[model samples]
Target: MAEDTLVRVEHLAKKFCRDLKTSLWYGVQDLGAEFVGKKKEEDIQLRNKEFWAVRDINFELKRGECLGLIGRNGAGKSTLLKMLNGLIKPDKGRIEMYGRIGALIELGSGFNPILTGRENIYNNGSVLGLNKKEIDGLLEEIIDFSEMEKFIDTPVQYYSSGMKVRLGFSVAAHMKPDVLILDEVLAVGDSGFKIKSFNKINEIMRDAAVIFVSHSMPHIANITNKVLLMENGVVDYYGENITDGIERYFGLFAGDKERVEYNEFATIEDMKVYASAKYADDPSRKLPAIDYRDPIRIDLDLKLKPNVEWFHIKLQITDKDLKIVGIYDSFQFQEAIKNDRDLHHLKITIPNSIFIDGEYSITVFIQQRDPINSKWNLLAVYRYWRKFNMKASAGLGYVPAVVYLPGQCEVV
Candidate 1:
């Protein structure tokens, strides 16, 4: 590997042996059908089932270059990261790297559950090819940066989710890797801490060749100098920056391309749908002054296309920092509506207490819940369905002050 190239992924490929339809019934049915000396096509199809997680993916990250990986879920971004980290071996091809590599695939992923946070930090450092002496030298810095001073001795098993994340991130950040891969690890942290973390990341991005996997388009576009847009299992497009790649990627999903959602379904022929952050509510309105503390009002002219039974909306909200605030889905809560009406109006109010004030984003997918015992008629799952400046009200800065502290300082 050249000194200028921090990491190079050459013809990388991965295969997943997906047991799509093998079941107890398949065994019993196979035995019964074998009595008649007939080999069923269903069993044969299941035997040959394989899914490609990544296919001949090739790319390079130059030293100090930030690369944004953007795509729908199940895209090869995370898999690529795992391969890079040596957590998972690629079935074909190779990844060449220079210098120590630091990765945050998931919150506390490499840590031993039984170990204390203090121990896990050292353990994760060792996994990243760091020596105990190195970890010891940087121990105080890691703890101080993570702000896990009080809970450092306690076993990570008892640590809060946010604390665990901070600890894990601190260890990775302190590793001083030539290459750093961040996969949505910033999702769990307090506001003030997250601000600090973002600043730290910016500092790191300046020195290391960073591979950032996130759903926040604006963040990617704003931070990274180059963007790799992936879909299915291949690179769809590459751009000079995040904004271009995202615009090109979403252009593939949108049918009419209207500011307002033209139709509920992304594609009527297959009933496919896709969306970005803005479309969760009214797309036409860039940044509406919605009362964050009060309930959010929404009304949609819903239509049950033929045998539709349920509706699910996958909503992702990001704060002003481009950090992912939360991801919510309606299917997690409500049951499907079973009435056979062609068109039904739905007016619902989401309690605004959940989200803090930064501009929220949303993506929607409507599906019939479960149909085994109930209704198997419309149990189809859609494969691929995938925010702007807001004025600050007087009381707040960028986002509305959803949080009201109990005490305040009196002006002297």
Candidate 2:
């Protein structure tokens, strides 16, 4: 391990048995083997009803570095954090830790339910090796930072989840440990507290190593310099390229099937999307790729009910986070459609796409205008009907905005 490395994990693995009886029996057998000094290579291998919760994981975090641990639920992220925090022992490998470690891995993990919040603060401080006088010096700061001064004397059992998060983060961060481990505990905090926590994390990253686990990509992007993407108890991707890591994380949840809401007024026969600029087809990506700001064309084939005179089309574009970024309405530009036959072909063209570099999906709506109320009635709808990727030039890096618009600035 390098002198600057505060935490190091080598081929760390852990497993658990599904059945309680079998698990207890295995534990006894392992204890017997340990007592007799009988060790076998197969001991680390999975037995019946056993599975690896985390396997062959390797990573290192040095001072001033933050690692974002991201994956789908049940991907062994929490398990890995628990092992790092010494709450559980690894079954197969080793972990080296230097200096004091502060962790908010679980809500109220270090707090006693019967203890008052003030007492727990001192208790946690002492556990982190701070003397009573030193804790006294930091007590007021921690209390003020937590913003739970009113409830400082209240028993922890009465604290809400958010309150616990605030107090837990306050103690862990203020203790000034060399390594910090946080596991989605901030998600329970309110927006203001989250902001405060992130600010504190930034301040701590100047000297401490951090391992943060979160499902939110925005938070991961903002806080982590490196990323470790996990899947099925193993490393899926691990690198400093945060953008690539985020993209791969999004890829895990790709391949969304087209879902449509049916109605008797109209039926969509087929839909296709095209880009004016050169298209890049990558088999690994679930959606087709096009250059950023490329002109886009959407073609739709519809079968309408007899005598249906008009309908409106709407396109709602959402980013990978599933937040709506843009919308297109046919009624904004085109008049009511005059259906001459049962079958119709419609083409919508966006001459200049404003979408920045990222994955995006389109939701389509087909509606008929009610003659009496002048309101639109849905004839058919498509949820996440199509997905596409936009590849930008090298200069645009990690665009924080949803759309990119070229602009020129002049000094006055």
Candidate 3:
């Protein structure tokens, strides 16, 4: 490990049994072996009913750095977090930390449900290694941050999920540990509380190494400079360039790209994308890459089932983090298609580019008109149907905004 490293994990692995009976039997065997002074066999290999929840994981975190973990559900993120928080032990490998660690893994985990909120605060503080006098000084601050003063004396068992998360996060952040591990606790809070929580995290970011796990791409992209993308129980990508990491994360859903589905109502296919310079000779050629100064175009071929009355097409652009940055619908160009046809072709064009440097995903949507009101309603979705990269020189300078808005300036 590096001298400045706060957290280092090497080849850590964890496994679980699939069948309850088999797990119980294995537990009994292990306990009997321990009782008889016999060494238990190593758990490095899987048994008949066992599977690795997290395998061969490795990463390091330095002081004042944030590492973001991203993956789909059941991708071993929660399992790894449990191991980091010392709530569970790995079957193989080791994890070493050089600093005091504060973790907000499961909401209200350290709180005694039967205890009053005020008492739980002191208990949680003590668990975090704070003395009685130290907790007394921080008690009011924690209550204030949680906004639960009115219910501070009430039993924690009666608190709502949002209230519990607020209190839990307040304690973890205020404790000022050398390392912080947060796992989707923000997703439980409301929008207002989320904003406050983010503010508090930013305030303490300079003092601690943070590990964050979130499904929201925007939050991950905005909070962390380094990323670790995980796949089925293994590291897929780990690096400093968060944008490329995000791109690889989104690329996991490649099956959604340029694929068409057929149903009783309609079929959409032959999706294509192109970019062109202003007044270029060939306006529809596929672009190797996108320049912010060039225009973009899309073409789609579709067929409507008999008895279909009206339909709509929508184009959406998402960034490397899978956050929607731009959306333009055919309805904005014209009213719903009223003519009934067995087959139809559509061409959509944007005359100017508003993008900055990054990978982009283009999603296409096909919708059916509401039977009663005639408004467009989504019926099919094709996400990441096309992807394109924007050159770093797309803009003269680095633009922090998602898409640059072109406008004419006039002095009144």
Candidate 4:
């Protein structure tokens, strides 16, 4: 390990048995082997009903680095974090730590339920190797940062989930440990507090090594210099290319089939996305990649019920996170919809897209306006109707915004 390295993991692996009885039996066998001063080959092999929660994971975090651990649920991210925090022992491999560690792996994990918040702060400070006078100096600051000064004397059992998160993160933030391990505890706090917490994390990253586990890509991209993507208890991708890591993480999700809601008065029979002369005709490509800001053309074939006339259409574009980025309405263009026959073919063109480099999906909505009330009735909704990928025009590094608009600078 380097002198500046605060956390180092080497081929770390851990396994668990599904059945309790079998787990106990395996434990006993492992104990017997240990007592006899002999290593069992089976220790490295998976038995029946046993699986590796985290396997062969290796990473090193030096003093001013933050590592993003991201993956789908049940991908062994939490398990790996627990091992690094010493909450659980690894079945194999080694973890080397150099200095004091602070971890917020679970909400209210280190708190005493019966103890008052004030007392818990002192207790946590003591656990972090801070003396009484040191903790006294930081007590008020911690309370203020947590925004729980009013409830400082209240018992922790009465704290809500958000309160617990605030208190827990406050202590961890102020402790200033050499290595910080944070799970998704920040997700529980309110928007203001989350913002505050990220700011604090930014401050800490300059002085300590951080291992942050989060499902939010924006958060991962914002804080982590490098990323480790896990899948099925193993390393799927690990590198400093945060964009590539995020793209691979999005690729793990199989695009959901089009979902209909409300009245199924219309159905999208076929949908195709086109960029320039290249027609997205490959069935194997889940999301066809296109150059950024390329003119996009969407062709949709819809089958509508009889008597449905003068209906409006809406196209909603969403990023890989399923967050709505932009929307286009047929009413804006005043494009008349001719429902003379039951089937209809509509082509929508985007002269130039402003979306940044990332994955995006489209959702379609069909509605009818009541002439008397002037209110629109949702006729159909096709969720996750189409998906596409946009490649960056040039390597401009990381632009946090969703859309990239061309701009000119003027020097006067």
Best by TM-score: 2
Tens digit per residue, CA lDDT, model 1, 1-412: 6768998887777666656355454557657777997854333432345667887788888876888888878877888788888987775777888887888888778888888988888887877777889889999999999988998999888888898879877888888978888887776778787778767777887778888887766557556778888888788887574444765665554332113333443222222122223345665754444543445444444455564545554444444333565555666677655546665565445564344334444333344545566532322223222242222233432222334333468999
Residue 50 displacement (Å), model 2: 0.5
Ranking by lDDT: 2, 4, 3, 1
Candidate 1, lDDT over the whole model: 0.65
RMSD of 3: 5.1
Alpha-carbon lDDT of model 4: 0.87
Which candidate has the top score in lDDT?
Answer: 2
Q: Which pairs of residues collide in model 4?
A: none
Model 2 vs. true fold: TM: 0.95
Worst 10 residues of 2 by lDDT: 275-284
Worst 10 residues of 4 by lDDT: 275-284
Alpha-carbon error at 334 in model 3, in Å? 6.4
Instruction: Give the Å shift of residue 200 in candidate 1.
Output: 1.4
> What is the per-residue lDDT of model 3 for residues 1-412, given as tens digits with 9 covering 90 to 100?
5777899999899889999999999778767867997733353467789998899999999887899999888899999999998998887888998767878988888889999999988887788789999999988999999999999999999999999999889888888788888999789999999989887777777888899999877688777878999999999999887777776886686433455443446666577666444424544534346567676777888777666777788888887656788898877788887546667888878777678776687877878767688676666677677876665443243344677677799999
Q: Give the candidate order by descending TM-score.
A: 2, 4, 3, 1
Candidate 1 C-alpha error for residue 6, in Å:
0.8
lDDT for model 2 comes to 0.88
